[model samples]
Target: MSFIIDDTDIPEDDVILFSILYSCVTVVFAMAVLSKFLTNEFRFGFRSALSLAVLFLGEPLCQFFVKGPIGVVCFAVGCLLVYSILPASHLPVGNKAVLITGCDSGFGNALVAKLDSIGMQVFAGCLDKDGPGAVSLRHSCSDRVHLLQLDVTKDEDIQAAVSIVQAHVGSEGLWGLVSNAGVCYIGELEMISEWITRKVMDINLFGAIKVTKSFLPLMRPAKGRIIIVSSVLGRISFEGYGIYGISKHGLIAYADTLRQEMRKWDIKVSLIEPTGYATENTSDSSMRLKREEIWDTMDEQTKATYGREYLDEIYNNLLGIFKMLPDDLTPVIRAMRSGLLSKRPRERYPCGAGADFVTYIFGLLPIWISDKVTMSMSAMPKTAKPRIQMIQ
Candidate 1:
């Protein structure tokens, strides 16, 4: 085949290079299309895969063969193809009902506004009814948005929420349940006591499970979705983030198990594993003070082994991660929106650019390499060897 574009400024060698690179890109894109389809059981239809493949291959192929500028035409065609097959979530979802926990702030609050803007009935679950986020949502959203007090850790609060949601959803049934309420704590495992461990796990993991269980009856009727907000730490663990990571890790397992069991009712379960974003959980002041408090609780033997200097360095490193977190929470909100509104939802939605790589790719590497790479992010304190001269 003649692979050259006529009347082009492109050189022959450059064409060869572009062709090779474009081929690789095309293959990868095709693989993604195949993988997404097989895993989702062709949820979007064959056209969805075709549309995506065309979007990836068309533009590049046009540039290589037809004309470099023809790539623009391919992009336009690809967009239209995708639009035709895209689900209803792209537009307003009216009449459908969704309940979001932790609407007091962060992704949950933003999602309430987004869904409300689209004319969907939103139930905003807040731990603090009078808190700033709930107040803002109540004022901004339409009458369809209802604010309900919910504490995921408490059975009474969860049961109360269930009743409120049932009353609201009624015959229509709840279309979505978003488990976004959770807490984060930073410290080594040794420093974090059994109480702290239970506290973190209870809220982050058990709390999500509690909310989901309460709403399952409603969701089962509508074949609705359950979207859990997890962290990238759920996919990759680090040194100081032990407690937080454990909770998220447990959440992932629960979500995965629920996804299978719920298949009988066609209820969708999706985990939004997002890169850290700027939220109350990632607040600089709260985390720094938290580290100090956790350090004070450590036993003398543990403190001596790790030393205060190590804690200081770790505290500083934690600050860096929080600072680097993106201010926007849109990616996570969008993922939940997709799960709630789409015909076929992915099992796992990793938010942000390189998330899939870390979640899927990096996880496949050798354990030693992965461990070294994670630990190398910051140094761990070294313990001194015990003297043998006394025994001799």
Candidate 2:
């Protein structure tokens, strides 16, 4: 027997089903285009989900707020907003000018190479003229890479960079700013020196803001983008990373606020949060251990009271985990490019497998639950006292 349906007798359920299907397809299509430009899956996943949620719920909610054409208008506007914010597939490419800070190593170096490889003009900011990053980029990309001596924490460097951009690209030419330069100091919260804490905040948080503020005026007219390189630590805290975590936490707030404030100007503010990546910093485990040695010496009494055996075990555990984690910087480079080039760029991107999963789980949990989990996972039991104490 053949099934037949009268076109005029279609059920309301069918209509709703069709609408929902169409809506979902549209959202997914938009997200796919966005994912290409976004290098970090974490950022793309969170932002796309949020926008889709709003779009899916918006029209139905409008039905309650208003009736007929007015409600329809509101729904249409909401849809447009969502689409407008999604990254576009056909974003302009080639010869685009970009300024990246902290190109001395790691993400900055990787970004510089990636952008230059794709034929974009890269202006890299290094902490020193003779820094290894500048030397390497200059050796490889040569003319495509312009290494500027920049200390993000210094006002002189910020002003100089602004002038350099205006001169190189003029007002209409510069396209993006990648604020990737930052520092990290890991240790017990109470044991970390006040000087170190302030220094970490200065570079990771304040430096990013300084660079953005200095260049924002130039970007204001052209709707240029700013990509802030944060860390997974910003979203989730861990043992021995208190100061670094504090810096990242500040960035989370800064990036969010900047995103809202810049909406009117059409200047997009995106943040890249990457977990442990193989960079010069992570590779130099010996240097980190040496720093710990100095701290250990300085706080010998505290170390003795706390029990050296326990501290040693904690240190070893941290080192082993760091060694096991992947050190690839490619993901960070991808995320940075996506933030700069995506048609509907996300506000935040989390890089690395561990970073993605951990941030997602932590973000979903209640504050209290997350805190308990972190504490439990990071805690170490006390150990017996050292057999002998050395006086330095």
Candidate 3:
């Protein structure tokens, strides 16, 4: 009648063999789970789920087979060892050339150094080749890194870049094309002028498309990789950043379609979607200035529609959020490197903390649930109560 009526009739050797068999099965499961966790952009949810699985399923299975606490410890140690030695699928980097746009600053500029350090031939496309960001890249990177004065928004620049790249690579062909050039603009949809919207779309959406298309011929010969840097907002729209999100959203659509179409040619396409980071484009001070500029430029009626206090409140809350953002661009740079060099590259790299969770919710949840979840996020429009009628 007790819980201890166990395996008294079973042979000791038989029991030991069963334990070893279960341990092997568990090791395979653990390896698969750990590999998915790392390669799938480090999803925090996956880590949580892994913990739950181990607690509920793994514990019982281990107890039934191995019959001791020591078995559990051994299992954990095995998982750790497996993760430590997980093999990365990386292509040969020697003599491979990669072209990255938006090298004037931020992720693009940082990635130039990263690729150059890895001994990959880097073609850094800067909007202003003589600017400070470009100059720093020139000084920091080795001779393998070449600087090209290229603007994504300009057809002339795109054609010139093609010619320059063709001349250098010759018959070898370009190995990678990273469409990292983009502009950030955050404003209410109504408050945003037509020109401003076009500017954002031109740089963030059309520019990326043109750059990718222009490089496809070269990429086809080498069966190169295409990595597009988008934002988490591209997947889930946020208040006060409609235009910027739209542009990114467009890139998401383009990249997804291009991936399927390029399968025949063996070209790989990937998307890097990151959350807020302390880059020049997302600097708190610069954002504040940009918000203030939008406010200053609004006409009387438009201003009346949204009071000055409303704009300030939105930006103030956002500034607080921005201040807490991680300044390190390493995770994003690593994603780009993997996208370019990995033999089996991931289709989407969601970089940043909580990014995968948020994207998962928005992508799967219902509209109402997503709205509620979005509200829970910090510095959103729902939190900012706007007064439409200004007092005299």
Candidate 4:
């Protein structure tokens, strides 16, 4: 029943031993958590890990290691615990404003509604301001949501948007810029022509770059956030998505460079890399049409070599992958929200079912091994016979 401990009853050696054991256990667990979360989730590479090691262990080595363990444990645990909680506690929305591109549909359209509901001023940049998605947002959202016609690939459109956004925001500046406009192209590498590749790149990679550059002036003063909606394909490429994967991969490179450069201004850049999801572009009918268009563009020799059935098999393989995808966009929406509002936003968010596991395994594995694994999982089914035959 006594609340006090008797120092006389316990030996001094036992107290030292107990403290050492406790510190050892705490340090091991802390290291594991930091390695898993920092390397995989935050995408912090080797340099950051080395710097963190110095930070966590520096004090522990000082003062002949006495009182060092307690200090290290307290610092690591306290800082990480607070860091975990900070992301969930969003910043005050207040009168802050955000502009989301590709608002005509999908993630951009959904994010517009979500941010607007939370009281942030929203500029919904639609490819067509009169389009159904834009009209729906106009009718559904509050007076604070403004709709602008923003086609990212067009220099004129991007410039006009800058002018419009600047006129409205004045000196307060834009709080966030979501470069969500993108197009997908799924076909064999040979089937995808230079023209097709260029078209996809125009919207997915170059468009995003141009839009971000134009808005940097507006965002620089506010030290705003930049969220790029990339794809899981950015980390790992598949057999049929050559063009799409290339564009997304380019985005990964651009975001990395931009993140480091923006640090001086305190602007944060984040990427949302989602796996397969049921969206308008990924619908069965739309994909079918795209397949047909690609097929039509091929020459006689090309068609004969790859064959109709072989091409059909590619489409079938994509549908099989889609079957496993979640139709719910909630995960992606939450990631976008975190990227915009979190106190400590992740560098890259792998969103969707098994996205983290999939990206990690395939992204880090040797290319040969990853290719074999990818083929085993979702490669195109073989045709009955080889398509090559004597032309004569």
Model 4 lDDT, full chain set: 0.80
Candidate 3 ranges beyond 4 A from true positions = 1-10, 20-88, 376-392
RMSD of each: 8.6, 7.0, 5.2, 7.5
TM-score of decoy 3: 0.83
Q: List the residue pairs that clash in candidate 1.
A: none
lDDT of 4 by residue, 1-392 (tens): 75334455447786576457556645654565566455333334343454466446643443134333454465455445534532344578877899999998888999999998889999999999999999999899999899999999899999998999999899989999999998887877887767778889999999999999999999988888999989998888787778899999999999999999999999999999998888877878878988887888777877888889887888887877677667788788888888888777889888876787788777578899998877676546654443777888
The clash numbers for all candidates, in the given order, read: 0, 8, 0, 0
Q: Candidate 2 lDDT, tens digit per residue, 122-231?
A: 88999986877788888988587888989999999889988988888875757899888887665576556667677778898899989988888778766878898888
Q: Give the candidate order by descending lDDT.
A: 3, 4, 1, 2
- Residue-level lDDT of model 1, residues 310-333, one tens digit each, is 677766767776788798887777
**Candidate of highest TM-score:** 3
lDDT of each: 0.77, 0.74, 0.81, 0.80
Give the poorly placed runs of model 4, Cα more than 4 Å off: 1-88, 384-386, 389-392
Top-lDDT candidate index: 3
As for lDDT, the candidate ahead, 1 or 3, is 3
Query: For residues 1-392, could you state the per-residue lDDT of candidate 3 as single tens digits?
Result: 55432676457886676567556657676667566567643434455465446645764555565554455565566455544433246777978999999999899999999899889999999999999999998888899998999999999999999999999998889999999998886767888777778888999999998888888899888888999999998999776778888999899999999999999999999999999898888787788778877887777788887788877877787888878889999889988988998766889888888776778877888888787766577364665555577556
